[model samples]
Target: MLHALAEQNTPEVRKQARRYAEQRIPLLRGACVPVSKQTPRDLVDDAITDIFLGDGDPWDPNQCDLLTHLRGAILKRTWLEIRHRKLVRYSPFDLAEGDVETVLARERPHASRGDISPIVFASMIELVATELRKIETRDGPAQVILECWQVGFVERREVMLLTGLDDETYKLARERILLRKKYLPPRLVAIVEDLLDRSA
Candidate 1:
């Protein structure tokens, strides 16, 4: 089966790869416990796609069998899904954890500006820009977020679209901002807190 998956590159081999993945659906489901219900299914699909696309090196004949390899793939992908969930708090552009309606109302274009005095708002923006520059190494999401902000993208949805980031990259960037937000000056943090308090 490993040989077929690695060498043949034929429909029969692809079919066999999917068959093996199907056999491990239960294992995948068990591994994805506490994750979204669709995660296991997505992992299986990813594994199958990997097999069909020949994305990874062929399974070493001496290292493992088809079942073992498929299970490992399932487990690996499941872990990534779990980690992503841990990092990501809400859907793109949604407010962090809090009163959803209130946050949304505050985040509205006009309302957000009205919520803060001009001087404080300018200070907050300057603080964020200065602090972001002081960070020697920024993660992908952080960089993307900074770029979006520099470009005057206040809306998450617009930032996402303009940045052309996939779901994982976007989530990662957002997570970095939340985690790194603490490093910002106290006043900046307070302003950010008032805006959106989702932590990494």
Candidate 2:
């Protein structure tokens, strides 16, 4: 269906694209954190344009349906807009005590340079630490791993060595941590939503 639409520039294809964008606008808006000066309609239109023009990432029909592919593209565009806004709003004084490069080096030595603001990055780390601490309250191995991660020993081998966990145990602890994604606390969600709103 997507291929057929992309290959032609007929009035019917344009009408279909408009209808698809209209249908997806509300859903994409609700899912994405808001960006200043960019509306959900804008994102939807851009995604549709990219897909039809072959200017964005290549779409694979075998991998997913057209709707799913369109959603991914819109979300990707939203993320990029958010990052661009962050970069535009960033100031040296945002990290008055230290520089971005220094903080990035200390907190995440393995992470590559990206558009994420240092202040936002630190907030994300704190949020992760808060969730990890909740897990640690019930799981001993989680506590050990969390402690190791706090001190920047995040490599699997290093964490295992410091925590004295075998491969299976380490994997189990990691799995438990990953499972937290399905059950995020409401307070955390509210906090993140508020941050996004303010950022926008």
Candidate 3:
């Protein structure tokens, strides 16, 4: 039906698209966990557009029915959007003004009078950044991903889109970064581990 509709430009096809979108709105909304910046209707519309006009993989009727194929596409797009929202909004390194103090207090509870200097915290962050820069020297994607993170674009798809990196390159760059983390300062590692633990 989609292939046939793609060959024609008619009001009925447009109406059918709208009807399909309307019917899937509830399903999209339910599947879009944690809510996304794009509404369910928007996702449905975009999926319809991709199926009909985008250069994505052509829908295979032999593999699945239209609604089933649409459900898969809508869910995939919705999850990607949700993941983007989560990554953009939540960064382990985004230490607000007082967050550093809280971390110091927790990590250095035995310190003399809880007077951990902010300079120490700042240096830890810089050390981690420097280590990442070292990794960047070997992997261009590492640098691109870091820059993207600094500017609030951390989702895999968005990072790939912005940097024009394919999946394999991005995965390898990430693996390199993760591998380099073992060489980071112990204090920095401890701090990151603690942050991850708390976030989890």
Residue 78 in candidate 1, Cα distance off native in Å? 41
Model 1, span 1-200: residue lDDT tens: 54555554446544555554444332222222233334444555666567667685455546655445555676556546544643553334433565423343354344332143233433444555676765446366677677786665745567788888877787777766666557876644444444332211
Instruction: State the displacement of the C-alpha of residue 94, model 1, in Å, after optimal TM-score superposition.
Output: 41
lDDT of 3 at 91: 30
Q: List ranges where model 2 is wrong by over 4 Å.
A: 1-38, 84-89, 92-125, 129-188, 191-200
- C-alpha lDDT of residue 198 in model 3: 34
C-alpha RMSD of candidate 1: 16.1
Return the clash pairs for model 1, or none: 141-173
Task: Please report the TM-score between candidate 1 and the true structure.
Answer: 0.30
Question: How do the residues 67-164 of candidate 2 rate in per-residue lDDT, one tens digit apiece?
Answer: 55666676566555545755565456334466534454444433223223345455554655566677857688877887887776766777998879
Q: What TM-score fits each model?
A: 0.30, 0.40, 0.39
Model 1, which residues run further than 4 Å from truth? 1-122, 135-138, 187-200
Error of 3 at 188 (Å): 3.6
Q: For residue 162, give model 3's deviation from the true position in Å.
A: 0.5
Question: lDDT of all the models against the reference?
Answer: 0.52, 0.57, 0.56
lDDT per residue for candidate 3 within 121-199, as digits (tens), equals 4555566677777864556888888889777676677799999999999998878877876887676555444433332
